[model samples]
Target: MSDFGRKGLGDQLKEKAQPDSTKSTLDQTKESASGLYDRAAGAVQPDQNKSATQQLGDSTRSTKDDASNQGQGILASAQETIGNAAQAVSDTLQGKK
Candidate 1:
């Protein structure tokens, strides 16, 4: 082969061998851009909204506890009435009159 042709062929081979360098640079640029996007996303805050939501959750829990206690009291009262009725029936049957 002639010298110029050999030189041209070598240059083509060098370019082919170094193709990954371009891809590496592109990947690094994508990483930097993604890092910037993450930082921007992190900068956003929901401070007041979060606090309000927590307060609402606390209020709901308190209300549920109150309702549960009220229901328990009602059940206890019904049980007491049943017990009294059973005692009266037993007294009448055993000739307590």
Candidate 2:
């Protein structure tokens, strides 16, 4: 066989022995995309560390605390009003006119 023909066969064999560059790059791209998707899923994941019932319990506790504070404020205001009314009644009864 001519040296040129032998060289051509050798080159063809080398090419076949090597993986296709385009297919290799495409596989890498697929793996990168899969990794990105996994990270995004993890980032957007709700506090999986906490259950729904636990979160609800915390919210309920906060709301109860808020209501308790509001009730205390109202009670304070009512007591003040009553004290003022009592003072005014006592002053009127003493007839300081």
Candidate 3:
């Protein structure tokens, strides 16, 4: 069977690893535009009216968005940890702590 409409494991991992800040300007714009389109389509064609494939697509998009958000949270936490470590080193060097 063809899984053409589905995201592969590698693609999902890549999406999770890539934070929005790292995306290029064009890529970010495209995502934003696509999101707008999806929202408009959803408003015009609610879930109850959507076909099985379309519903699956929406569900997949939601799951991907959630994963990306979680990944961003993890990335932010890592950055915070690194920043705190750097601050501690600076304080130690300055004899403040």
Pitting candidate 1 against candidate 2, the one with the higher TM-score is 1
Write candidate 2's Cα lDDT for 1-97 as tens digits: 1121122333334444666664577765765565455334433445454345434433454586699999999999999999999988998999853
Arrange candidates by lDDT, descending. Answer: 3, 2, 1
Model 3 per-residue lDDT tens digits across residues 46-82: 6776766666766776787799999999999999999
lDDT of candidates 1 onward, in order: 0.53, 0.55, 0.69
TM-score of 3: 0.62
Better of 2 and 3 by TM-score: 3
**Model 3 stretches with alpha carbons more than 4 Å out:** 1-32, 43-45
Better of 1 and 2 by lDDT: 2
**Who wins the lDDT comparison?**
3
Instruction: Report the C-alpha lDDT of model 1 over 11-69, residue by residue, as the tens digit.
Output: 33454466555657776576556545533432343335334533343345458669999
Ten-residue stretch with the least lDDT total in model 3: 1-10
Give the per-residue Cα lDDT of candidate 2 at 96.
Answer: 52
Candidate 1 TM-score over all chains jointly = 0.47
Pairs that collide in candidate 3 are none
**Candidate 2 runs further than 4 Å off:** 1-49
**Two-way lDDT contest, 2 vs 3, winner:** 3
Error of 1 at 53 (Å): 1.3
